[model samples]
Target: MTPVDTVDLWVIPLDRPGDETRTAPHLDCRESARADGLAPPRRGRFVVARGATREILSGYTGVEPKGLVWRVGQWGKPYVELRQDTAPVPAFNLSHCGAVAVLAVLRNGRREVGADIERVVGGRAERLVERFFHPDEARYVRGFAPAGREAEATRLWTRKEAYAKASGHRLLDVLHMPVLAPRPGRRPGRGDGTDTGAVRRLRDVPFDDGWAVSVAVMGSADFDVAPRLWPEGP
Candidate 1:
């Protein structure tokens, strides 16, 4: 887990995030928990995510995981208070959906990065498309179905979530914004540097059979995604 990796990411199961690797520190859960009185699912997942994140960060920072730390977001996004003599300038975002949580870290002068992954549950894809996807995107999604449609749906959902996550907001009130679309040969993830196509054929991101993973980058000349995974059951 050296720092030379290309915008590395770690997707850990909220249910069972094993020993913390210290790539990051789980510094947000306690405050969020007390403020919101988390639901069972959120509590469990958040705890595991925190433990692992802390462990990960510890490995990198040599900082142990036994303290109260605050990861306050300016306007609800990650922000760090600059300490004298410390050059704190890197970009990252955290997102969790269903039972999994992801930590995306970007370095080497990457300004901003966002990532999202969603399971293509039964009708959730179509329903979300109708409810939020841009109109033309809806039609484009219609061109595919239970067969080749997964990819499209995954792309839409991931793009949507990536933006929301990037903006430090959830999707509850984001439907009014413009929808995202596919540009062939675009970077593998949702964001990167792909331009939205004409007619905006972005009715929900295409979904793969197992999961839909999308990422986006804003205000950057070059952006990309590097993926990491941690399974729940050993």
Candidate 2:
């Protein structure tokens, strides 16, 4: 089990060779059917992302990846079904964009946790801010210079997405929600040493340039994020 105050954030690169072949065998029927229905690269990516998720969770649960069953919530969140398992299962959420997939696993007695990653695209930032962002969040993005606007926008976008996923709320419903307020004694954009120390607060997860990552969890206690790359499979 993960430490009570820690959330494991796994950053996975989905383009590795034989990713599909290696992970495919571990996917259950529904996932395989879903992959079969998708076209070219999307099918391949889906296979890798879902398969990798199962593999990672398996390491924690002592269950084979194929033995894991998933159930979806009314709000469209997917959760593992622990129908027959006696071991504790970690709460987790997954998001993938471009060639990278991110998973956030929480074993701290919190069931609501989410993670997201997005490629930074400057041209669409202003328009999205104007349309969906809260007034404060919009201003936060606008406060950045043109050169920095996209990264700021992407950061805020990921945070909002992570929160929405964690809360089981529709993205459209929470798009206007504010996420700009910083927790006491914490600085924005610094995930390494900053702790939200409470629920409903967003944490910015540092990632490679050109990509933005964020994780959100529910609870009224302090928690820290430990980011690590997904280890290469044998």
Candidate 3:
């Protein structure tokens, strides 16, 4: 609550029990919000986001999940009041793609984080990259065009989007980062590595699959990604 767990990721399989519900995973997040001494979220979307959040926080606190009051910013970001008198603690971000939702937790009062997931469909990856991304990024994928051009494009797109989301920059801002250079690569731990992964700048923004996974962290110190699945309550 005061400090924060180191940057790490916990990806949950939606197929598992207590891993598929909308709010089940986040119950743990709310517990942390409360354990940290924050007021529970009263209601609205904040409640849903809060619930999803609780599930991720559960990993750290290992506490029973509970519903708490939550608040939202103008841009639809969620925040839990850690205390009645003090301002909310560290900021958080959330993104969902099909069956997957990625949550980013920050410790240093971050204001926003946006993540987008796009499933790659056939050759659409190449076309999209040409249309939306910078010339350099396009070139990076083209280099791999002979072997498997589509996959190349998808990886660049996700990394680019993740970087954009972290920057809180608009879809247009992705251009600021070089698209031609094949995105910064992060050699997956050999065996368990993603087919696509790379780090951009010092923020550690990386993603795989031109399916277009992107995240922008709005001015924060720490970041972690947690995959949430609905939890079953009996």
Candidate 4:
């Protein structure tokens, strides 16, 4: 069997009290949160998410979470910035929804990573597809039985968002782009389309209780993903 690159995914619960204490020392993170002008609860979520991200990255780099520097791309993607002599940096991305946050870490710093978690709620799935999905994707969603349409739409939406995040593109930029269905058991190097050289894969995060989470990684190397809930404690 071909060796696959691996990524570590950490899922964190925002409701925990310890998250605050763990992340509070990162004053820069707090400044960013305060700048958002979000309400208290929303700001709290931001603090936890930002803290979790730093804590996770620090675990791998041995750098204090607050000491790590970041650079944002023109399109709003954020990545760690490392000095030339610094040890290999890891690529990471963060996403949160409802009461949870997901952080994806790619050891190969050259690769790009993106993640998104969405709460599943009742809505007019068909109408949403028409508004947000690519023309072909919308038709594909509609083809599903009405009963399954919403689930299918949610899955595809995650896929689309994941891809956009990995590519460092905004969701709006790729909403209309064609997304190929995932192929099972395919070799890692196989190209699905014109962009085959970049490894792109999406996996369902087994989130119970009405949540959908997906992570996307893009690079030349094939990767395996290991997902785990954040361990208790700071």
> Best by lDDT, which number?
2
Q: Can you give the TM-score per candidate against the true fold?
A: 0.68, 0.88, 0.56, 0.84
lDDT of 3 by residue, 1-234 (tens): 655333333232233333324553445554435434533322323345445566555443443335334575543445655433443354555655544455665544534445555676687778888787767767667877454878667656665565555454444555445533323464211111111342333233344443445444443234445433333245
Candidate 1 residue-wise lDDT, 1-234, digit = tens: 333324557777766434323322454555445524767666566666766655444443344544424365644766333232344334566777777777766653345556677776667687778767778767767888666565666667777677665555557654545544345334332232223431111112233356777655554333435566653244
> Cα miss at 104, model 2 (Å)?
0.6
True-structure lDDT of candidate 2? 0.78
Instruction: Summarize candidate 4's per-residue lDDT along 96-159 as a digit string, tens digits.
Output: 8867888888886767877777776665555677897778878877787877677767766776
Number of backbone-clashing residue pairs for each candidate, in the order shown: 33, 0, 41, 2
Give me the overall lDDT of model 4. 0.71
Candidate No. with top TM-score: 2
Please list the C-alpha lDDT of all candidates, in the order they appear: 0.55, 0.78, 0.49, 0.71
Instruction: List model 2 lDDT by residue over 1-234, tens digit each.
Output: 544467899987788888889899999888899999999788999999999899998887878889988989888999887655586778899999978899999874345888889998756766798778778777777777889888878777888788878877778776866676474224343121122343464687778888888888766444689886786444
List per-candidate RMSD values in Å: 6.3, 4.6, 10.0, 3.3
| lDDT score of residue 34 within candidate 1 | 55
Off by over 4 Å in 2: 1-4, 183-199, 232-234
- Rank order (by lDDT, best first): 2, 4, 1, 3
Which of the two candidates, 2 or 3, achieves a greater TM-score against the reference?
Answer: 2
